[model samples]
Target: MPRPRTVLLTGAAGGLGTLMRGLLPAYGYELRLLDVLPIPDEPAAITADLADKDALRAAVHGVDAVLHLAGISLEASFDKILRANIEGTYNLYEAARAEGVRRIVFASSNHAVGFTPRPMGTDPLIPVATPHRPDTFYGLSKAFGEDLAQFYWDKHGLETVSVRIGSCFAEPTSVRMLSVWMSPDDGARLFDAALTAERVGHTVVYGSSANTRLWWDLASARALGYEPRDDSEPYAEKLLAEQGELDPERPEHACLGGHFTTDPPIWPH
Candidate 1:
């Protein structure tokens, strides 16, 4: 049997973080959870601000590898993204280097390329290797993470993989989701590929499902041995019936689900 690796997972209290926390144990990993809030059930969790160098160092100590999911998640002010996403990610990479951790799996998002046109509902899903066309501050923050991954892999000996997650949800909720939905089971597959793949240095891959209707080519993901079984296309008819059609010309509908292209932006007023 393979030895259990110590996996330090940040943001264990958040949605995706929580999902990964429960799943890591099943994958033969000794899990260490981290978040600003207290971990549920008081499992082995570190509560601290990721931007605090000393705190991050403490969290990284003795962990063989890291799954960095901690960061501001949505379209927020530049200040929030800078502190939580940018600085916090930097702190993790530095801490990982100091602790001699071997690898890191970063949680990037589809928003990183939100400016690119999402082909119409009739078109195939875009592939994982698309060029980044960020649409919001949050998207830019994820882009920074990708760049940081490259720098760390080049300067230090650390191996890094950036998973640009699409819409991760319990189920497809809207018309746009037909192209973006990523189920938890599929997410686990994506992360598993990142964790155990061979010779992946600072590579960026989309986190999506194996839907036949998906637009993106998953050849890069397949190279890492990721085999997603779920498909978002099944929910297409139902979601479209409920939400009605969005103007394909609208930025939100036209490109990358209008996440960055939406008018007025979905931010606090």
Candidate 2:
């Protein structure tokens, strides 16, 4: 089948979503924006909570594919995570299936495997087959999303690509981010690959630039035709000079998820 051209982009107002909004257009996609929060300068962007099933179905109608990015991004109380991340994702998948959307690109997080030990020295890169060891309610929700994607593909013929994204910022600010940072351009490239890849039943891939200090393997991502261009090494010197080298003794630096494992963030009520 030809690549899906009309896509429903959820979470249109968030940091990453906004970046995608600008870049995906360059790849010949007609994005239909949706989010609970209103997107500026977009009168057509749907502003509805994920809990609203009726609005979700309406938002997904006629879209060739869905890029599901709406959810509580940080560690939150279990209830919040359940509602926004867990149940909310379910609602979107249901809507997509009901609307006959061909595929979904799920924005999963590295925190889903937060407890996994980071590769040091010659240690092997973490594989996509790594078992889930979520360190927080937020991470748990992402893990749930991954499982849900698989279930949908198995039973409902809904294809999905669950991207375990690292820090996708314009620049690497901290030593930890240097290991996992995905540049804005590389992120766009990964998404484009995911959208166009063939025979993706329920693929799982790490999302990051070709960083020199990468902790996870990119083979799965590359299988989808993703070729990450940016590297965080240029910024490594400044970050290392300021923060010093990662000490294996430090709980935060010992894992791929960084401080998220050491101190899980709770959403402020």
Number of the predicted model whose TM-score against the real structure is largest: 2
- Backbone clash pairs in model 1 (N, Cα, C under 3 Å; residues 3+ apart or in different chains), count: 9
Per-residue C-alpha lDDT of model 2 across residues 57-112, encoded as one tens digit per residue: 99999999998888998888888889999999999999999998889999999999
TM-score, per-candidate, Cα-based:
0.92, 0.98
Each prediction's RMSD to truth: 2.3, 1.1
Candidate 1 per-residue lDDT over residues 100-178, each given as its tens digit? 9888999998888888787665666677667777888889999899999999999997888898888778887877777
Off by over 4 Å in 1: 1-4, 121-127, 263-269
Indicate the residue-level lDDT of 247 in model 1: 80
Residue 122 miss distance in model 1 (angstroms): 7.9
Taking all chains together, the TM-score of candidate 2 against the true structure is: 0.98
lDDT of 2 at 8: 95
